[model samples]
Target: MRIIIVDDEMLARGVMREYLAAHADVEIVAECANGFEAVKAITELEPDLVFLDMQMPKLDGFEVAELAGGKTRFIFATAFDQYALKAFEVHALDYLLKPFSQQRLDQALAHARASLAAGSGQRDAEAAAVSAAARDVAATRVRPAERVLIRDGARVHVIPAEKIEYVEAQDDYVQIHSDGKAYLKNQRMAELEEQLDADKFIRIHRSYLVNIECVARIEQAGKDSHQAVLHDGTRLAISRSGYQRIRAVMQ
Candidate 1:
């Protein structure tokens, strides 16, 4: 399996590279010094697995996983115990504490191999059965809407995603409208779309994205254009191209 190691410490990255190099099945594709570099490398390289450090400057392991969106299996390598709970929240493959032994690394690799095998498919019947099982498990593990980290000036605020009525695009940043107030975040609407759950949120317009639960009614404004009135009395104009996507969920 192709792998990438992400850690702020050079020694940690070197150690992981050395260990992975010895394994015939695993190939060290790249090594990142920080979370930003890791994100860029993962987007370009598309490795099968990533050995990520939990704590880092700018972004942490959980944030990286959120941005990754299941593109690669994440194995968190951390020195702290506080991140153990958060690691599982993102469906990490495994957690490796710092100063880990060769035996522990072998055990983690074995588990990863088993997981990969279980997810593998070739035959039609076998593939269908595995796919069905995976879907069922994923549906069962879905979490309720809760707090979302939003950038408020220099600090980040954890606000409820359900409380958000709609989002408006403002140049490079998106303004999150919620609770009769708007919070400006340094994130693009397109990037935010990937992070949000599709079932709960819908892109109604090029400049607007609304929470489905907040949508009160849809008004036909023109031949192909439509307007969605949110529960908070916010109006969002929908284009002809976006109508089909919103209609499927409305049904």
Candidate 2:
């Protein structure tokens, strides 16, 4: 079996490598220290399995998985327990928490081997089903993010939430508009909506999430639909339901 290990920490990678060296059936094809490298390596190597770390600079494991799709099987090894729910939602082959023992690693590898032998058909089916459900309701209610991360080529941007004018859904990603510029971030609109302070941001349409402070006026487009004019003159479609929701922010 061919495998690739992806993690930001050299120590973590070395430990995993040391443990895997004893396995006769597996060949270590490549190692990546970040999501960008992981994406490139996985695309080129197309290894049978990947050991993915959830938290890394730039793109996280979920974003990498989003970019890679479900072509390669994955076993998550990360220190974070927060992603446990999201990891299972994607129907990953297995998850390994940090500080794992050789025995635990062996158990996860055994599961990966069995899944490989059975074929990827079932995994693909469950992945598609879960992925669809996950995006529809991705995050939970709590403290909203004060700053959001965006990756544009080699440049990583950290935009403050207060400066954001609005967000629009684009395919699987969202375009965050702020300060006369736009940045595309790989995240679900529903998930993002839940993360932003409820009093500051409101969903004005199924495709649009607007910062309440940026809304300049509400224009009646027709009897059934309306438009939300931002301070910069950017007009956004407002659904009937959106019009009602706008009342909270308008006050």
Q: Number of the top candidate by lDDT?
A: 2
lDDT of 2 by residue, 1-251 (tens): 99999999999999999999889999999999998888878888899999999999867887677566557788899998877767755567888999999999999999988888877686677678877766554554357778777756544576899999999999789999999999998888987888799888999899999999999999999978899998899999998899999965686
Off by over 4 Å in 2: 80-82, 128-164, 169-197, 221-225
Candidate 2, residue 168: lDDT: 99
Tens-place lDDT per residue, model 1, 1-251, is 98889999999988888777668999888899877677777877888888999889867787776666554778899999866755654556789998998788888888777766766442334445544654454455445435556543334555677777888889888998888888887768876665567788788788988888888888888876789987777778998767777888888
Per-model C-alpha lDDT, please?
0.76, 0.86
Candidate with top TM-score is: 2
In lDDT terms, how accurate is model 2?
0.86
Off by over 4 Å in 1: 120-251
What's the alpha carbon RMSD for model 2?
3.7
RMSD of each: 9.4, 3.7
**Model 2 lDDT-worst window of ten:** 133-142
